[model samples]
Structure formats: C-alpha cells, structure tokens
Target: MEQTQSLVLVITTVETASDAGVLSRALVGLSLAACVQIDGPITSHYRWAGEVQQSSEFRLMIKSSLSAWPELRDQIAKLHPYDEPEIIMTFIDDSSEGYRNWVIDQTT
Candidate 1:
C-alpha cells in the first residue's frame, strides 16, 4: 500500500504583526501555503551570535503540503525581512478530514 501525504505545519516568529501579515499573504498568494494563522505577541528568549537575546514576537503557523517544501522555503527566505528568520516545521501525522482535504485543495 502506498502512504498518503498529510498536511504539514510550518511555524515561524516575526518581530511585528506587519511582518507576519506580509509573510502570510505572500505564502498564500503564491500558493506556497494553503493558509497562514498568525497569533501572538509572545516573548521569545534565545541566544543569537553567542549573545542572549529577548524580544516580543508574533507567530505564524502555515499550512502547506510536504511536496511544497522547497518552493515554500525559498519563497519565505526571499521574502522574509529577517536575516535569519525562525522557520520551524513539523509533519502532521493526522488532522481533520475536512481540513486536510481543504489544505490539499487550496494548494492545488
């Protein structure tokens, strides 16, 4: 039996809502992502270039297909304002039938 590809969750954080909106719109507009959910004003604490850093950020959780990874990544890199943007990815083993099918349909 062949395995079916499921939906994927791509998470990233940006410094501002405008940045989040820009990325969201660009990804969806370019068909790189089926949908992008923005939520936050969360505080992030991390180390950057050997220094401790802290900041308030908004998060974007993008829904896309596994097959769309390469194009999505490239598009985010080209369009993201950050020199090193946070791009975290997790494969969703399962999801709602309606949502999963909707994601595939939108991307297609």
Candidate 2:
C-alpha cells in the first residue's frame, strides 16, 4: 500500500445555504478541495464584538490535503461574507488509508 498523505476537514459556516453551495463549488473547482459536504442550519451561539450572538448557519465540511490548506483558507476568507468567519481545520490523521489517498488524489 502507498503511504497516506495527511487529510484535513476544514469547517466553515455561512448564513445561507446558497452561500454554502457557492463556496463548495468554487473550492472544488479550484482544486482546493476534493469534496465538500454541506450540512444543516445548525445553531451557533457565541460572543463577538463584545456581544453574545446566535445565528442559524449552514456548515461545510471540506475535504482536502494538508498541502492545500493555505490557499484554501485564503480563498474562504475572500469569499465568506461574515466579518469574522469561523474557519477551522481538523486533521484526520487517523482516517482510513484509502480514503486519505482519495482525498489527496481528488484535490491534486
């Protein structure tokens, strides 16, 4: 079996489902992500600008390799509407080898 490349699941939330769709397509089109899974109107409650706020958001789980993170992050920032968008990355170092390779291959 070939060595597995590091895979990452980048998370970001948008106010509307339409925004999620657009961002997902753009990332995949740019080869920044292999696949983007869009999930739900999740509730988010947090403090921002010294105020506690709540919002209904659509979350995107972007699958990509570690090598693509920097460009992907910048692209997300450029496209996201929120002033302080939540862009988080979680490394899936324990992921199945086949899946990891697939994500890397698709991104490349």
Query: Could you tell me which residue pairs clash in candidate 1?
Result: none
The segments of candidate 2 whose C-alpha lies over 4 angstroms from its true place after superposition are 1-4
- Candidate 1, poorest ten consecutive residues by summed lDDT: 1-10
Q: List model 2 lDDT by residue over 28-97, tens digit each.
A: 9999999999999999999988999999999999999888899999999999988988999988757787
Stretches of candidate 1 off by over 4 Å are: 1-4
lDDT of 1 at 60: 93
The top-ranked prediction according to lDDT is: 2
CA shift at 79, candidate 1, in angstroms? 0.7
Displacement of residue 75 (Cα, Å) in model 2 is 0.6
